[model samples]
Target chain A: MKNALQTVLALLGEDYDSILQAWLETQKAEGVRRPDLFSDRESRRQLGDILRGLGEGISRSDLSEGIALDADSWTDLRATLDEVTQERVERGVSPSEMATFILAMKQPVFARLRERLAADPTRLIEEITQFSRVVDALAMHTNEHFIEARDQVIERQRAEMMELSTPVVQLWDRVLTIPLIGTLDSMRAQEVMENLLNAIVEHSAEVVIVDITGVRVVDTQVAQHLLRTAAAVRLMGAEAIISGISPKIAQTMVELGVDVGEVTTRPTIRAALAHAFRRVGFSIEKVENARG
Target chain B: MADTASVYLVEHVLLVAIPDNITDTEIMSLQEELSTRIVSDGARGVVIDIAALEIVDTFVGRVLAQLSSMARLLAAETFVVGMRPAVAMTLVELGMDLHGSRTALTLSHALRALRSEGLA
Candidate 1:
């Protein structure tokens, strides 16, 4: 009797078209194959590539191991799955949807194997077990790749958001401002300090206003982060003004007995700017309309 | 080898630029040189620029702190200027205090700050 792996490979070679047709039918029936996001022609081409790739490597792939996708013989198959995974992830396809392409093949392959090995009940069961193992491992590999691709995108977006949130804008010739949003964690506070110091050096800024208007929480850790940034700014010879303290955050700070040290804190950005202007030897006056 | 990179006198302010690869012996001699110059030239202010220095270890930090206090005894104020962000973070991490030493963004800013304090 041919071994289960060989039997499955034989069925893959002889009944390729039938198996492909059955797999696509089950996918369509189960709503796994999204026609709206992927064209029917492209879907067939992708499925054909994966099926051919499997046939090419399934012989060398050890059915006993849980993961055959990592085998050297299955490099081409892995590449095909990776391409499919990337495309689907970009298309906003869910993990289940990405895995279904590999999973739906189980029904077609199992059905064909059962038909061929019907006279030998024990061999038919063995082939079914071996085939399920291969398909399950492939499904997991596809899901892992999909999640990794999505994670990469998430990591990139997070970095961009961080850099975007900590902008140090020059408010005056010798004054700079950084309007901070979100929580002032250690990492973010460090970034803010770096940016503030760089701006002070770049603009020879004598004073910096850190507006925390968008930040809601004022725990001790955040207060410490703010103080550290202020100290760093001072170390660069520029003063730091912690601005935009709401009544609630003020109450929290007072209750927590958070000492902001010698660094200045203002109630609002306008007030901070005024204080900064005074420190930098500048003044702002509202001009009356000439029409008067 | 050359003590420090350069030293310039602007009015009562002494502008000293420190190189990245300064040796420990050179730093000690440089501090001595600065102390004598403060007394002999009647220099009322000192600006130590470390923009060229990439690393500021605890030893360097302690010496800077001491240098400022030493200058103060001689009736001269010290300001460390042009400290890179990395060095500042490292100093803050090490919890090094400059005592009465002030910091400035540049040599020019340090001079201005000292002048405001009536150095000139």
Candidate 2:
């Protein structure tokens, strides 16, 4: 019998128990003696027949009328069951399991009720009570499963986002140079911001050079991300030197009406480095010698 | 609303052939649907065929990241397929991280990679 109960519970998903519990409460409110339904085999059999009929497409209205269960009360019970089942389905529980659970609860309750039919043929109170207990258990289990599934999804999403945002390298005492090797989409922009800020603070970077020589093109959105990164660096009291302004990117910037005049740009990383050195009051004599 | 396209399953891996112009809403819906299927059936991995995509924006990148995490949660792996050179260049220029996230040059290659990793 316990195995049967477990089987039924597994099949019903989660809300079946809750629906049964609510029906029992409704029966009790109407002065029905519910406990005797489980003790009697005839009453149990009758309950089973009714549940089988319900499963076979007998409406809850018809079941209530046939069993002397209040029509209005049964309607409320059906609504609650529907609500619970929908909730379970939305949470990714299979519908077949839910149906099986409902059928399982009906079996024991109806079997007990069938036994009681000989003593008091109209007594459905005990059957309703038993159904109520089983349904409550099912509902609790279903709700727990739903919550577990939801949490698993949320946790996975959080972890994945974290992985995506994971910094490629940590900043030490040296002025780390991160070459912007590809397109500057918003997602990568946010990542660059976080990484650069952390590196600056950790290493107390005197100058951070972002070389975009490898970038093939620049759009307005990408430009905005760069500006935002520069602003973020300034807030951290560090200098951001953007180098490798390809002629194509420059043309796009102008065409897109983006004014990056305030952003210090250089033809290459070497030029940006020279500018950085000059800012620190040190002239690169090698470049001067080459020019000489 | 477009019809929910059928997912192609092969050797425990689910392949979703997404159109080039995938919207954010579509990505979100796909994420939800794929997550449900993966959990219910316990798939080995998922490969998103992006061969048709000419350009990828930030939203798409975020969605891929989300999908990767969702697949991991289901004990499945995720891979992007058919990354065009031009699109790849754009992603790099835009500062998108393509490294460490599983990627393949073709759908068949992605599947093979997953199989090699014992995920498919």
Candidate 3:
């Protein structure tokens, strides 16, 4: 078994350029390679690094010891795998293609071992089985790493959207306006309320106009969230005026029996702003054109 | 702890400054003292200066709300002033807004609001 692995490692160390070329061809034949997404220079450098790392890693591992990616010898291999996975995830590479990239190397390595040890069938089988196990573990590792990188990207985007979704703008000395858009889940609702309350305190706002014209739907859960936000605004000693209650939403609320209690709802944002101006003691009058 | 929340007469309004390290017993005693002074001192309003309080949990929020109503029953208005932004957010999140309890940005604002309402 040792002799068989020694021959395979020797072939890996001496002729990786040919093996890597063969690996790329196999992946292309399987229709997993994306030449459009990857420049030739980048593809060669990335695959070349992995081939080097794997050769160094397998040289220190015992063939019968099973897969130990945590082993000191596999450090280079693990690091290379991590880099490739992160790059692929950022480039929008399909996960199946990532896993297949590692798996395709098996065909090239097996062919190299066959040509060197085909005179002895038992040795060829030993090398083939040992090399297969190593490739399978590496493939599985690549799949998991890709998933982790993708999860991180999703988590960051969600955080960014949360920040962008809730913005409290101070429209007047003691008045703030929040124009809400999109769906209002419970978590997002909580975020909105927290941001509004903090802004009220920051600006010492006495009245706040929560405009929901951009909201597409007003389900029962959404109504509850809006009500809770209104209650929170009042609790902060600021008056809440819900504006832009579309006719459809009004009907839905009435049908759902969702009572807004003391929350003042207006027909449009203009009306709500007018009410806010009134609460803050701002009277607007249209002057006749003096030029006329 | 018992004397952490101090109530004193400022003009016709009773000004109460609650400390951050005030204990539950201190709050109960303070409430008793405040109620007594509202009648005895003939104050038209009570100004709770909670700027000294760093954290206002549900207990403090509910207490302020109850105190407001109790003061109203005794012919006096209660105003909580100088509430920190974080404390206000926590009160709202806890679903306790100290409803019926008026709030002001500063001690002077609470006093002015209280006095204006007294005249009205």
Q: Which regions of candidate 1 fall more than 4 Å away from where they truly are? A: A1-22, A59-69, A108-130, A147-161, A172-174, A202-204, A278-292, B1-7, B115-118
**Ten-residue stretch with the least lDDT total in model 3 chain A:** A1-10
- What's the C-alpha lDDT at position B96 in model 1? 72
TM-score, first chain, each model? 0.78, 0.40, 0.84
Please tell me the interface RMSD, in Å, for model 3. 2.4
Write candidate 3's Cα lDDT for A1-292 as tens digits: 3643687789888998898889889988987777887877778888899989988888887767677887898999999999988988898999998988889999988888889987998989988998888889999999999999999999999999999988899888898999999988889888898899788878888899999999989999999889878877775567899998999899999999999887899989899989999987898898888565
How far off is residue B41 in model 3, in Å? Answer: 5.4
| Residues A1-292 of candidate 2: C-alpha lDDT, one tens digit per residue | 2222332233333444443554444444443323432333432443344343333222323332233332453444444454555444454544444444444555444554555444754445544554455455444544555566557667888777655543434222334466776566677777777777666656656467777786656888888777767655543435677888878888888999988645678878888877777654566454544642
| Stretches of candidate 2 exceeding 4 Å from the true structure | A1-121, A124-163, A166-168, A171-195, A206-222, A234-252, A262-292, B1-120
Candidate 3: lDDT of B74?
A: 89
**Candidate 1: TM-score?**
0.82
lDDT against the true structure, each candidate: 0.85, 0.60, 0.84
Structural similarity to truth (TM-score) of each candidate: 0.82, 0.32, 0.82
